[model samples]
Target: MEVAGPSFLLLILLLLAPLSVHSTPPPYLSPAIFAADYDDMLESFRIFVYGARRTFKFKSEAESLFLASLLGSPFVTENPSEAHLFFVPFDGDLSERSVARVVRDIRADLPYWNRTLGADHFYASCDGIGFGSDRNLLELKKNSVQLSCFPGSGGRFVPHKDVALLPAGVAPAGEGEPRGLSSNETIEHLAYARLGAIKDPGLVHRLGGDPGLLIESEPSDRETFERRLAMSEFCLFDYGGDVSWIGDAMRFGCVPVVITDRPIQDLPLIDVLRWQEMAVFVGSGGGAEGVKRALRGMARERVERMRGSCVAASRHFAWNRPPQPLDAFHMVVYQLWLRRHTIRYARRDWS
Candidate 1:
């Protein structure tokens, strides 16, 4: 999800040769997860999940699923000495002091911290609040992978060092099932929201007048929501924090249209996938006119190609139990694998 311009696509193309195969294959071969090599480290790479059991438990079912996926993976190790990486799982509800206490205890009890200065140690927490408050924890996190759904910028989330954790969502298709495009829905633009920024009178007055664009301020049931999204060629997503809709739109075969002024860094698969090829981006300041202009600019063939790409990429965003090859869980692991070289520990000290 690290934000870069079109040049990123070139980098992806160049690096495609090395990042195209998963560490573990066959019994768990998934192309989506198979893209970068960690210098064969993944073949023997092991992670030790430290911290108390209670500290790792999450209130959110989705967050808990992420932990379950990691614990069930083959790369986890029972002994710290066998680990290439360390994980301290903390939930969103835990306080800064609680997180700090866990890190302090781990530093004292484990030799790994002193050897690497905690560079190889990482943590996963869904919430961003209270993470920046602790100086010691902040310093440690800066050197390690801080996985989270909100990979917001500023402090601990250095794009090159951290990983963007996608929210847990239902898979678009079952294993071996065909991913069919939506044919019933015929709407061109479908948006359901109450945000004032999106509903600006001047902008809405322009785009709303068109029958092709539909914006409903009223809330709808899940069934209705899915139907609207499925029918539309483009689904409008606000610049708001919640990005659950991006996955939903892809699931239903609607190309995502992100409306934001700032550069987007935390978009799912931004590091691997060519987002400009799949999703439409419009500046918030451009108003509804911007949205209309973007849509107008796209030819029919181009829109279809984008939708095809969305369907192809949807499987990577899925949440599967037991963690399939390139499912959401593996994608998170892949992100970590991509950053393996960024945090290096002293070899002689560890040896």
Candidate 2:
């Protein structure tokens, strides 16, 4: 009788409990810059420019423009003491000494670096030409968010911590411009080889003589390239130095057929963008057969759906002058925002 009574009571208690769970609020991020003192609205957002001149001019113009765009955004804060994140705007050649000098100076001048061991700090670089060789830079890269054009796996690119920036050429289509979805091109496949040769011999051989595929040894000039891209239904992308052409393909309403053995680290807005919905990924082992299989598997309706998604996702990869919402610049910031959500910084006395 006692056991029966206890079981009855437990059943009643379980029945009365609420089933739904409430979601938590997003974390707040107030990013602060550790740059030189300047009077040009350094305290305000969207107008304040990071007061560092182009020291290492590798892709100086692109670097300069990106820095200006980020610094001019509302995410920046004047007071380091009240900030939740830190940014070190350093541009030039990716020299360990130059980066080290900036890091050392900032760490000495501010307590933020010591607070999180530079975990919350970030540096932006468009040039991936020379930063890989230095051991110190590699270690530094491990600790901070590295925004660059070459955000690949292995080496210093930690996907959760670093950002892969979209190249400058992938700008949004202007008004009256022909979006790629409506193209009437007869070609089914388009491949441009800027690197002279394909890494996979099997893929090279398979696509080399295919009548339906257009394999160009050299890229056409801008106008011709866009025209060819606009005409095709599927554009081929491999593990090249940069995957920026994916953006171009999407802009032209072509579904990208990514053939890579390694992970694609430089995909723009990956945390937010559902890449599988817009592009096709063929593994290295699959070779040309895999690519053809993927294309064959995609029914006309599914291909149309993917093309629609690609058209929708194109704007996220586009760069605007003032940085409109969801554009490339904002997308980078949004990536940083998402990164901020992953981290929980310990409260420290900035006073």
Candidate 3:
């Protein structure tokens, strides 16, 4: 597994060549079983942020903009030489050519990209899998750490290498407080659910008569939505891998019932967070009826326990200004710290 010192540069070149693919999946280690020392991460980790200029074509760059603002933060270094990681910030829609141009710019203007062929770098995007069609973007996904909302191994995300990033504007800055029902509060509703608009019509038609569930398609204002979410015991989401809805549900003390066909790796923060404790999963194999059975079968005590865990775990999904301890921003950084050696192992010919 070790790369010889002399062949390191040659390996980097090989990784940089077009059509060169690293197919070996990274080693799998669950962070849930072990405790992460945020103190250690704070003391040892530093990142150098790339000041890439954006043309402001798209309005979906909030995540990148927020991280870009961290250039002067304690976790950031003025000198790239002393940094353990590099941050690439981009605004506007991502395309194959646009992605390639950004990397080309970095390789031409800086010396660091040559060091690891982008294995030591990372970026954030709220737009999930929309920019994944291009060859250059696929290469970037393989080598660079991609902080994205839709992280599925079958598509754009590489689990151990990439981190699940929270979408921008989901949780306001400095708003990490749990907003759901108290332990003693009377649980009035069983669940507040919304199947994605794209969900199968037959499935929705079948679940409409379930008395235990309140499935709403009517658009509600943010205030009303949160109000309803806070009252429910469980929040059902089939939003096609939108992490914001999951975060909102957890923020409101509603245990999530995620119904998806994607692999478990698609879930955000699965590397560190124990999702089974905080949320319920319903696979496509079981169909819509499986979702109902899973929710209805839970005992009151189990429901309460899961609800509490949702509140506790929601902090990791909240984005705070200046990056609060264990918050979403810090969690993403911690994931990077966990994969700091990605560069050294970048040359493995998993293909």
Residue pairs in collision within model 3: 24-350
Residue 168 of model 1, lDDT score: 66
TM-scores for all predictions: 0.76, 0.72, 0.76
Best by TM-score: 1
- As for candidate 2, its clashing pairs are 46-72, 46-73, 56-92, 56-93, 180-252
lDDT of all predictions, in order shown?
Answer: 0.62, 0.58, 0.63
The number of clashing residue pairs in each candidate reads 6, 5, 1
Candidate that scores best on lDDT: 3
For candidate 1, the TM-score is: 0.76
In candidate 1 the C-alpha lDDT for residue 16 amounts to: 34
lDDT ranking of the models: 3, 1, 2
Ten-residue region with minimum lDDT total, candidate 1: 19-28
Between candidates 1 and 3, the one scoring higher on TM-score is: 1
- The segments of candidate 1 whose C-alpha lies over 4 angstroms from its true place after superposition are 1-42, 52-55, 59-62, 129-135, 150-156, 175-209, 217-224, 341-351
